[model samples]
Target: MKTNRYLPLVGGLLLSLGSQAQTKLATGSQKPMPAAEWIDADTGHKIVRLTALDGANESFYFHNNPFVKSLGAAGDKMVYYHSSPAGKQLYALNLKTHQSEALTRPFARVHGEIVGKKRREVFYQVGDTVYATHIDSKKTRRVFVFPADFKADITTLNADESQLGGAWGSDAEKEIYRQYPAKSDFFNRIYEAKLPRTLFMVSADGNGQLTKLFTDNAWLNHVQFSPTDPRCLMFCHEGPWEKVDRIWTLDTKTKAVKLVHKRTMDREIAGHEWFGADGKTIWFDHQKPRGQTFAVTGANLQTGQEKSYAHTRDEWSVHYTSSADQKTFAGDGGYPTSVAKSAEGHWIYLFTPEGDHFRSEKLANLKTHDYKLEPNVHFSPDGKWLIFRANFEGQAQVYAVEIAKAAI
Candidate 1:
């Protein structure tokens, strides 16, 4: 859709005013794949099990708005960080054979990207340093390292595959945790400190020459480059949704920064922002009075226009993801905690947003477990499949749903 075509004053805004839900039997025959079972869901989609560990530590979820792309080679392989009793590790699974190859082990909290046109190599971080490992040879190389005082967190590769982007907070992160007890234990906070928080864009190879794109006193995070515009990137002020403006965009060429979805009211809470397929519009979830109500919103970065649909009451998602075309969106209400406290029970959902209205269908009903459904929900490059994390079996696992063209 044209970015400027959604202007409110021009009578062009598409507004979905309220919430609704539907459940129906899914249609589709099961595909023959190893270590996998298929079930027909009420959304007329087929859900495929990518992993089959029962009551085991099978989590593949990484983080919300992750900088790394998990699916590789047109959905033939999926790279994910998994935690087990043995240790935390990274693996790549063959979608058809159900066979997985370990890429690295003894790794700490991680985010990874599969590189090259052939996707034979992977790059990931093991703390403050980023490393690259060969998928077949298991040989590794150190790609980049942050300053001794800085610890890089989430990482992403740019559109041209020439640069990598990431953000790190100053030493204030430790003091924040010490002074305030975090109810969720997740890293979302805005503290009163003078420590420097910087966003870096590093070269993808060799010494990985690093470039500081922006820095601020606030917590900077979720650094992602536009998929089509290499010089443009987006980051967020990480904190409680209502306390921060939350999103901002930066131009690497001109070194300019612009606030995205800037607060327009006293109680508006917006976060989990991401760019559309064309980079013309940005999507995020917004609500007033915190958890009471919310809507999935889209804003034109170039024209200053906006549109929203899929409204809901206290039951909306804490994070969301949409297809490249912006025609379909999926999310869950699960918070960061384990399934016991923050489970969605209703599980994942798919929304088909139309001109001022939207239709929602329950895509997957993930029963309660030790893991909460995460917000890594994403569509394949071709939009033929949707992928997400769930713990329907006890431990978290990744799954994909074959999206029926007619469903959207």
Candidate 2:
């Protein structure tokens, strides 16, 4: 692994101080809210708005769990999926009015399979049928169907869904869809239907038959299609007997697979690592057994090379976002970090530790290359805003940061 220079900045500076104030309680007693929301700078609108509906309740009730999913900008509007005691729903938050209306059909919840592309079209599941809905025309059509016995469980579906490829083909032509088993226990045996352990492809129209791209029975923990080449994919392969895990590359057309990285028995790759925007590199966390220290490695897929950004025993996590052009990258490398890249690829929103509150930073240097932060930070679909839920300022409340200089 290649080592880079270490330029340390001062520990704390309150970079976002006074730009925004914490929301106070109804009694003016300053009871900090348990969750917060933010808007993306590039889209010039709030992509997320959430709050604590169930006060201090942590029992496993689905309604009490507050989380955001399927946040993106489609056409002239911002869209997202949310769940509550009422049920699962999809909404289009009008950028002009700041109003949200349920787009999900009544009695037919928006299954976790929903995904939005660059156009106004959204792919989602209702019952056993996968449907695509156009936000502009309010038209919906069936895109695919599962086997008769297959059931739709939104929660499990959320866990199993993978964005294997980009929206490449036109609506009339070929489109790539990635499917995974909703249940982890299903990994023990191959489905009689010839489905793969994790990575499988089918026609967007659901006409062509399902094809298993990778034969390895090992569970494919994560799979990503190369943004540059839609026919190429990168995925992580693991099994019970293996001492370590490695990432591999596969060409769908040639039906060829190659081991891009070999595993060392003493260390394991972290599951949540992601590919760089360039599609030629992958970023992952490497953990050392019996040691508290961890390091982040960026591996070049073509050259079989790696570079380490940071190594520490501080229990830190890294969040990364790269420009659309793949020329610039911005991320926060630390514990409990949050980062969002602008869609135009010019700026990044970074939040770091500051006692009870998170100090926010809008950075323009895409070549800084090495840093670390805490995990679970999210970016808006337009890549202009960063949003997260945290217990800062005595309680969790939503906050937004503007990346004014990020338009590429």
Candidate 3:
């Protein structure tokens, strides 16, 4: 192995992290690890395991958007799923105080940690009922519930927070899901089924005026509204990426459907899309030929232009997220058995956009992590740490790898 010249400097910053966490709560599980930090042996990057204990602790999914930073005197706050003694419950962490407080009673099914940065609340669905729970006050408000006829789920909140976007599958698609409930079993089947999917919007306040925006015989998955433009809603033709032109945007005002990324050559594909902080560009995992060449590509929604920064095959990540400044990026790498079949890819990566390619640095080693639980990475609001969840420590726990080699 080639030695890093910074290893000496990296070694100086090491804080011994045992094979497992040491602190345990009175309830017989590891205590909430708010300040638990360590240097990864393989990469020499500091890794802080956010959650400790047995059950899976999770952060929000990659495309669910911001981890909600309310920069007040109390400091910035981020919400997550914690395996509390009460079972699965919502919890919020105060980064400044390094304190965590459980936010919700265990909900059977909470949709997404769709944090409202301005409102300081998280919007999630419990079954067909939607709720918004305040992070600071712990006050929960029952929002609108889905209508009986609408059999759809809320996907994204619009820029002005006026509307919530969703996709409704035709009965054919629902039946297909019933037959092959497992995604792997029906992923391709539902795509090939080409069942009609409808894109619609409802008042976020639940005033109940639902408007059907667009309908097509395509798998309209990954529905997201622009963070800066409420009028622009993006959705994908979810399927085997190579076989379909995945990225698309629809203007809710004009009902215009625009294909965001077009394949330049046979088998070129794009998916796992997300919007920039300003919502001007759409960034996604891009490959020129399926599992071959890899890059995180972006498209200018206003200019109809695209740019890509290439990376090695082994560096291909299941998901990539940009920093608050859009100056840096992070990736959650695939395991050896993944589609990339990467030999040395089990590490969380920090990527700097350099010319046509990326300058890659390994942040945390995940060689022992179970690939079944994807460590969806998100950059800190201040862009100092990359937060993700992993199961390498025997159970899934949220972790953050310091981007800087040494404490700044």
Candidate 4:
């Protein structure tokens, strides 16, 4: 195979054969091998026990966006949101029993992180009402609602609200910062309420003891909390009069404000990646004038020194995840499309182009400096099975290969 470093710009064509072939397994007969499990990088044990809930008949007909939004592994459950004709609905899939149930009824959208263990809490918006549902109990309670003309930007919330950096006592249970439509002159005012236009925090029990955090005439958008500390909140303050957007961090304890990063007239700074586990390092994509994209870098709380990882024209982003013992770093790598790890990390997943098809390789023991494997590799959580997601015909599916003996 030729080792060309550039990412292929070819049109979207599903390549079959080679590692993309679907194979049947013995243990999980009802589920296809490719869809059955995902190898855990840490222990090499198959972590995600997947089963096709719907849309399995048309071969290619599977979950369009069936990505797992939140995995409730501690509670032996998982929650995912799927787009439907009515709208997007949240579904709870029990991992142990392989049973599925719908948590939210049709109407409104469930934005932000879905919280909970066995019984999870889903923060969703309908019309003006913001509600939370306990998946196990099937109990739905109205948390808050938007005011008449107010709109909430759901994208502002972090993956699990774990990175909300503000001076709040605990993570805001049901808090949303809102803005009015573009045309409304009254859109600039900040309020603490359910929805419409409000920025307030609620108790876990749906009690609205709203406390006004800050009120500024400037249009505040994209409110995010620091991944390391909930008290440090960062938001973008934009106004019609201003030319460029400014990012600000608010110290909840001191109520002091600091300007972290600002953009000049010609360049705009966007894509804020707050390293949740490591508070200091923030990674973002920066577009250069030469038609090349560079991964902009920042420091975490501990390091307090800004640094950039190795540059690759293939395009790369940092995945903020510590190893099993938090001693090593691991993240997804692009360009060649693979997962990378720090020096001490054991497992590395890579994809190498083999003519028209691609092969997945698993490299172990970086310390020895000698590690290699065949393509289409998947590492189980316990390092027992290797599962691979492949595309066949016009359809994409998964396949698994036993790696328990191979790992030894």
Candidate 5:
């Protein structure tokens, strides 16, 4: 069947211009693997479980690059996490065939899903040691290990795949984590403590050369390298979203730091910042004053020109993502207990930017999904579907909801 590419746009416009209801999943809806795919009852769209793995499968964090998108004739592969009885490991799913290739064995505390698409490899950390594995060959190599004074998690890989960027938590921040362990226990306390944190990068050539970029007396985190500019890096001041000036850019060559978005209103905030596909824009989940309103806002990295697309409270998502071409956007909606305290926000949304606001069309109903494990959303490499991880099927597994309305 030929899909109408323009059909979804039409559906989005009608819903945005007229009336719409909060889409909800069927009671105890279960579209587990082996079934492969199912039609979302509320939205009439095809939703597919990416891989039929038997363990708890999960996708990458919202901003981290997971897909080795431009693989030419070989097609793209998405690297994700899996934990079974054998061991917790990393696997690359063949988007074309739905087959998975194991990339790593069981390792302790593997951090970040930083894919060096250029090198055709995935980079991660086991404590202070950084490792890179070949996507196609399953061959692994030691990238580099951070020194004692600069040990930190690997966050981003530079455009040319030369440098891996990250932030080192301060002793106070580490102590808070050590004592509290869980994010819920330490998140607030560390932020309020205003502990010192350092931003750094290490060479992928395995020389173990640590480049300590800079330090600040605030929680520095979410470090990302510009996808287009190897010398340019982006990070955030990790704290309570409402209280922090979150988005920032750093010039690796010059050691210059600039604040990306300055809050205009009293309680205005911008966080969860990520670089556009071209690396020319920095986009984030924006709100005028805390949980009152929501929008996905973007600021031109060079010109500082801002563009925002607003949505209703219930349309708000824990994380939002832009397609590879930057032409479309999608979000994995929030739950009732989310900070927005949404009454009905259980839909996986497909958003079309209609000037100042988004023309949103519900793609999948996620009413039964757990909110604790955030459904970090990403657009498929071909922009045909929105990929996200959900626990709605009783375990954390990655799924994709077709952007166009369809039945499988």
Candidate 6:
């Protein structure tokens, strides 16, 4: 292992603040509203909005992840990153009490993940190092550190919270963009160079032991773990939606790697892939002929069976996620790629995997913008709430809708 000489300089900085616990309650006039009377057209479940914050603070849910691992029901709290005048800080919102508390001191662009089903420990990265803090005790420990010149992208914690995985590299694509900056052909230029990127796993118990599971000369991104299967995890070769072979999975026990929904032809774009609630299947949004649209697609990791659950004749329903039971699927009609057309309107839809799939109903009318990131709708572990981010009140804010307070 290569030693970072600067680690000693920051050792004191980490030790000084490691044991300190800081917290503040959610303030201001904005408060979460009760369930709206609007009945979901398919399930007939009442929709309830769960958050209303006044300022620009927002949650960090990604488009490709189906579950908000950070927002699991420990203490009924949801963790999010807030950009204050001081810096970016992590905050936990207690759903029952409707209070937001500070979890860490303000730093540069801080985001977090919650681990363990019952214990609920949190993980987040600052610079090239990852840290863990228990939700109840607030005990902090340094989990892992990356080598010099390499940055961590898309940090993920495994199902049982035994390991943490991330994509690390020189971030050459971002640096190259500064040199050859172009609006349309920027990614095309970056792909011309085989940038060094690696998939790394480390002990989640703050052992600081790092293992490089896979390395590539391409842009590897979105490292995600299976929710049920302990040994299974997935990643992507990220670039223009159409250019790369999108999804790949790795088994930690066997060190086996396989492509989930492999593209056999050109213009077959498959990106924004995630695992289902069962952890047996991987789900993704795919578009053939590149610029057309996307449909809901999935591949069973155990059986290797692939199927399409939903597709569009007119426009694409780009991002796809599912309920915890895997019985329900949700999608937003907005595609974030430059090649795909601008979204027609801000709408999210829901569908059943088994019957009446065509009867996908509009769940919410989102306030969205062009050329900006779209809200990735995710379900809670219990499948009762749909969590998403939107710019409804001018700035992006995290919001959740209770789909079924009790099972219908």
Give the per-residue lDDT digits (tens) of candidate 2, residues 1-408.
011111111111012212222322221112342223222322333222232322211111111112223334322344444455666655554432334445565636665433344434556667756666666666777655655432222221111232222111111111112233333443433222223343555445446344455554444544555645666666665432134356677787787888765666454444345566556776665554423434456678778897654433332334444434433333433432222122222223353433322343443211212122122344433455443333333333222333443222
Query: Model 1: which residue pairs collide?
Result: 24-42, 26-44
The top-ranked prediction according to lDDT is 5
Ranking by TM-score: 5, 3, 6, 1, 2, 4
Global Cα lDDT for candidate 6: 0.61
Clashing pairs in 5: none
Candidate 2 runs further than 4 Å off: 1-78, 94-97, 113-116, 148-198, 206-209, 238-242, 288-291, 318-375, 381-384, 389-408
Candidate 2, residue 251: the lDDT equals 80
lDDT of 6 by residue, 1-408 (tens): 111111111110110122111111111112232121233333343333333443455555553332223343333556665565677776666544445666676346666554455446668778767877666566777777766765664367787778888777666677887887874566676666778888878888767677778888987877888877778879898887667887999888777888887786788888788888778888787777676654667788878888876455333554667776777887655744434555443456666765423446655555333216466677654565666666544555665544532233
lDDT of 4 at 197: 22
Highest TM-score among the candidates is held by which one?
Answer: 5
Model 5, 1-408: lDDT tens digits are: 111121122211211112122232352364443244556677877666665547788999988888886355454778998877766678887676455777887466465688888788888877778898888987888888766776578888898888988888876677888999988898999988987788888998788788889899888888889889999999898878888889999999899999999999888889878888998999899999999989999999889999999999999998888887777888889988787899799888888899899999998888888878888888877677788888877788888777877523
TM-score of each: 0.77, 0.57, 0.88, 0.51, 0.90, 0.78
- Residues forming the 10-long window of minimal summed lDDT in candidate 6: 7-16
lDDT of every model, 2 decimals: 0.60, 0.40, 0.77, 0.37, 0.79, 0.61
For 244-321, candidate 4 gives per-residue lDDT tens digits of: 345566665576766654444355443334443345544433333222434344444444454443333432322222
RMSD of each: 10.4, 13.4, 6.8, 13.7, 6.4, 10.8
**Global CA lDDT computed for model 4:** 0.37
Give, for candidate 1, the lowest lDDT window spanning 10 residues.
Answer: 1-10
The model with the greater TM-score, 1 or 5, is 5
TM accuracy, model 3: 0.88
Candidate 3, residue 31: how far the Cα is off, in Å: 15
